[model samples]
Target: MRLALAALVLLLAGPTPSQFAPAQAPAQLRRGLASAEAAIRAAACDAERRFGEGDPDANASRCEGVRGPPGVEVGRTSARLRNPRNAPPGWAKAYLAQTDGKKASEVEPAVFDLGDRVGLLRPIEIRKRCLSCHADRAEVAESTRAWLEAAYPRDQSFGYALGDLRGFWWAEAAK
Candidate 1:
């Protein structure tokens, strides 16, 4: 009778978390990382399209202050000089190394941690279309070239072959 009553109570209590199961941590982390990745990718695509349309400037400033879900902080940068704020801090350099030289990066999702938070690293590669402004000798618009020269005097992100790891998006979520 006690077992039956206990079973009934448990059934009425709805689904209880298992002792060995984490309480929504994994789900929250997955959702956060996914949202962050989408946010960064969309922002990058918009910036790329604008740049292709003759606006020759980094879009990092535009994406600034764009926050991900509650505890997720997202941002993007390159290993090159295009994004003046591309300096890799902490374990970001290591993650970039892991992603470099690989044509198709197999992202190990939510593998990094920042204090009590988790992180996602997404590799960025060069496409043939990106050569317009990034090729060392491509026939870029004179105005755009001059603007780039004036903006980034020591730019070194250009002259890359397609499939090159241009950079990566680094995002973190509270664990």
Candidate 2:
């Protein structure tokens, strides 16, 4: 009975730090982040190309097809969000705050030890290809803009120029 009660107490206390594996090496985390970012960029560009080809359904389908490395969860976030679901979590917001005034290339991947997991965040730069969906409101294709309004009613992720800091690509993995 005592053992059962003790186990219940421990379980209720929640996970302890010692239960988690050590954080992945910074280099390994960076490599994984880079791979995820590349996949995302490729998907976004492909989506843009397909949209240009007059495929109305191609606006976000290609980007939605992107997948991260095994055991890693990846996402994108921006201060100006198109999807409210992409809002940065507390840790990411803290990291982003430190990146003000710096170009994407000038910023490095940020690594955080998250007790049971590790997180990495890398800035994503706006490229020419990204303008189809993310440029000034007037510059985007009318069809694309219509799709954007229908899909994301409150979208605010436009008005970016080439080379601007668009947002961050973040990855989280077990420690």
Candidate 3:
């Protein structure tokens, strides 16, 4: 009777997370990275369209205030998701670590997965308008230019070469 009850309970429990795990982190990472990329791309397009339409509010303050470059909202989202603490134990750091005097844009999207556990790296390129907002110290506009200068004084984040690693969005999930 006890054995039958145990079997019944086991059957009712269904499959656990360990039972049918996902395949590769790349797919999930790609999806998440895609989402973030889409968001940033969309924002860039909207900003450009608005600016072209002579929308004064377009140059308002979406990328202003303290923190940092809020212009690439989707890019920021991607970065946040890849952070070690906020992300899974299997985290990664994605950035172009200055090759020559070129800065991050030279290397394209480089990612370092901290753990070999569960996750994949997905990179996204920053577009032209994205660069206008994210370009190095001097390339920024006069309005928020001061803020950027104050914030990233040693900003080596501009004048990117083509096919560079604009940045990446890491997707971490159960393995």
Candidate 4:
């Protein structure tokens, strides 16, 4: 009878916050983020090879082949956004500001403690290959520029140089 009463109380109260929290260890979270990042890079590289570098369509293919690992949320965001949907959270904006004028190789991944969760951020650098799509309007292929305009009409993601800090890839998991 006591067990039955406890069950009823739990049912009425619904799941506790801890129940919704990610239970992965910090090491597991790191591993998951690394795996997700590798998958995304591989997918993007394959797409670039198949569709020709700098094709907006190729860029879009990256997400099609990748999924965020279970128990964590992963995404990319930039201060100069092509997609407003990729805007960084409040905490991330502060990190982004710190990356200004720094090369990806020069910056280290940032880790954060959020009371109930942990967050990790890695810098995304603009490489030579990236310029085909992310360079100045005059430098990018006209066709690619046109596609970006049509797809992300308010795009502000251009004008980046090789070795520049492009943005960040971040992951969050409950502690």
Arranged by lDDT with the best first, the candidates are 4, 2, 1, 3
lDDT of 4: 0.68
Name the better of 3 and 4 by lDDT: 4
The weakest ten consecutive residues by lDDT in model 3 span 16-25
The predicted structure with the larger TM-score, 1 or 2, is: 2
How much is 97 displaced in model 3, in angstroms?
A: 5.0
Per-residue lDDT of candidate 1, residues 3-101 (tens digit): 999799667755432211122335545555565566665656665756544554455565645544555566766666575767665556555556555
| TM-score, candidate number 3 | 0.37
lDDT of 2 by residue, 1-175 (tens): 9999979966765543221112444553445445545554554465466645565566556555655457667677877789999988665775566664456777766666565566666678887778999999999999999999999999988888878787887766664
Ranked by TM-score, the better of candidates 3 and 4 is 4
Task: Give the residue spans of candidate 1 off by over 4 A.
Answer: 1-28, 48-71, 101-110, 137-143
In order, candidate lDDTs are 0.59, 0.68, 0.41, 0.68
Cα-based TM-score, every candidate: 0.59, 0.61, 0.37, 0.64
